[model samples]
Target chain A: MMSDKEPLFSAKNRKLLTNPLGSDNPITIQVLGICSALAVTAKLEPAIVMSISVMAVLALANVIVSLLRNTIPSRIRIIVQLVIVAALVILVDQILKAFAYDVSKQLSVFVGLIITNCIIMGRLEAFALGNKPWPAFLDGIGNAAGYGIILVIVAFFRELLGSGTLYGFKVIPQAFYDMGYQNNGLMILPPMALITVGIIIWVQRSRNKSLIES
Target chain B: MNTQSNTYTFLYAAIMVVIVAAVLSFTSLTLKDRQNMNKEIEKKQNILKAVNVTSTPANAVELFDKYIVEAIIVNSEGEVKSNDKAETFKVDLKHENKKDLSKRKLPVFVFNDTKVGKKLIIPVRGKGMWGPIWGFISMESDRKTIYGATFDHKGETPGLGAEISKPEFQKPFTGKQIFDESGVFTSLKLVKGTASNNPHAFDAVSGGTVTSKGLEAMLQDNLSSYEKFLKSSK
Candidate 1:
């Protein structure tokens, strides 16, 4: 619907960029990417790294898909999308392997799993297929950010309570241990991550009634 | 755009495949060196860990070179084979373990420890529940008692089997004897539940019996090759 005379960032495109952050959050609202959310959030560093990797892949994949949208055959669109996403994921995985070896090891196969992350494919199919490159790029970044925000938040609480640390730094004072404060060991487990995500969804839905389904 | 034509579809897929292959291979080829260097550093760190010496990735290479005085590739016959040709660091267990025991090049790293003096570190690998479980066992100069040991797994379940890398799991191996009182090579066993006050058998990780047993089997399998060498040395 954007015209040549309109402002570069119109209200419509701004909504596309901002809606995913809160009201249309991917992890909290759309409930996509819950697998990686529960898997890597035991520690904040890995979770943060995973989020960035996913963001890079998602953003780049969306742009590539959108740019090729015109040429992509109707019969082969899904395969085209998979090929693009896989290539981008491999590139990200290789770069991470070269630059951040430890974090790469911590993230492990999850970086490759970004190819299968429904959020990336969802955005490309729902938004990128129909939108222009710029709008698609913004949508990609917005949705990825929404997913990354939830990952970081979940990791924050998990790392804080499970290991009494944040990003590997001991945040809870040792004196607290002397006062019988025990880090919840259960929080380090996968179930606790699901519970944390559930709590976020609950709180979010409670505040925003529109997100609740009949 | 004749999108549904078979000719166009085949051409498109072929072109796409070629493009993806070229870009992926190019990326992998360029980053291979740095990735390998990181792996080497990690291996050095783990080897150092077996001797109670620790170093970060930044300083692992320097520390490794300073402490590890010799890298010998010994065969099953207890003979130290071609020193320069073998290139001990290049010995990969995943490959060597597949070869016949007699043909395998068993690399041993001699660590010059400050307190324990000279220590021999032998690397071993075996199958865990999920994937490969590997470790370094630091043997005292006598080659009988374990100075220290370190275990690492490829894809073991966290908090359960992955605890093999924890200090508590590795510490109990420090004073355990690899040989019995009569000089019988017993290696070590990861017994379930209570350890029965035996020096050769250690209690396995409670929830990680498979990985613990895998480590025990790896130690036995790899260490058996050193039996002739250990006996000859004495």
Candidate 2:
């Protein structure tokens, strides 16, 4: 029930979604969600799935927390956020088990660990607590999408070079193997994920001059 | 308004605890049936994997009903125990761990098949590269040939040691004999080379050295206990 003076869907509110992708991206600008970016980016399929799951959780959690901001006491705001996040994570885990058992098994503890992912907590505290629900939800989605874009790119190269495959399908021809072209096994390791992400940031920064400082 | 007593603090804490407990209890009760069903389905799925049958959770029960004919509880000596009060499937491995080895209830699943009329499925669990590895080994009616096998691990590296769970890795176990003609026990071993001409040995993964060894150890340790039962049943 926003007043006419404060429009529900203003230009500034719309900017919340697009701004995070370029100028004020959570990954490049704030440097959040880097841990997951480095862990699950070994394979394109897992990285994509992880990114979507994170986005859904963050956006929904932000909207819910923003809606309940008034009821949360200042002294116990953090506790309330944690409780809500934990409950939501459990629900998500249950849904995954019921619907997508194999993928859920593959994800295992990572889904449960979403509660500890700092980005969700940071967004809730820094933006959702003060902003209206719509804007906060948009911000959450925008930041998640930005993070997802970087992860997918990193996973693409890693999976291609490391396993010579994409989305679990053999992409590199059999001739490549017969010609003694072996997979770069190092690319499948966690350290390679870090180096790949670092290279992505380097390329992105070099191309986009403004992102250099951030 | 004055700072008189701490009654407010105590009351608030008490109310919060009661609310939380009630919520937890309600949630647990509501999901209890579904959780149990999921567990049953998961168990059936694992059993089917043991017999080289692949099926999703949705069709696990159907496949299990089609393949699994009977289940029995046997002692370490391989004798059928009249523990009618306790179902073989309901035997908890964790509870069996603390008890004396001789007293543990071992579940033996019998599968019905045209090729192998009745096969014995034994469950095995032990330490692996990262965490516990478990599997079910189904022996053919002759008690020598392996009907099928399945293995699973927790936290093992994917595409490496974790490949043990894949059918490509497990397929070698089928038709491999577990005992010599002299009734001498020669359990399957994860060999370094190709599967030996001798029926008792199976080839191990080259790169997954530790996990292969772990599988070998797990098979020997868990399956050895069933030898007495196996011998008597024969």
Assess each prediction's global lDDT (C-alpha) against the native: 0.88, 0.79
Docking class of 2: acceptable
For A88-110, candidate 2 gives per-residue lDDT tens digits of 67777776765666777788757
Tens-digit lDDT string for candidate 1 (A85-155): 99998888789889988877776657777888899888988888887888888898889889989999999
Which whole-number lDDT from 0 to 100 does residue B142 have in model 1? 89
TM-score of each: 0.92, 0.86
Which structure among the candidates has the greatest DockQ? 1
Q: Model 2: clashing residue pairs?
A: B78-B229
Q: How many backbone clashes does candidate 1 have?
A: 0
Interface RMSD of each: 1.1, 4.6
Q: What's the CA RMSD for each of the models?
A: 2.6, 3.7
C-alpha lDDT of residue A165 in model 1: 95
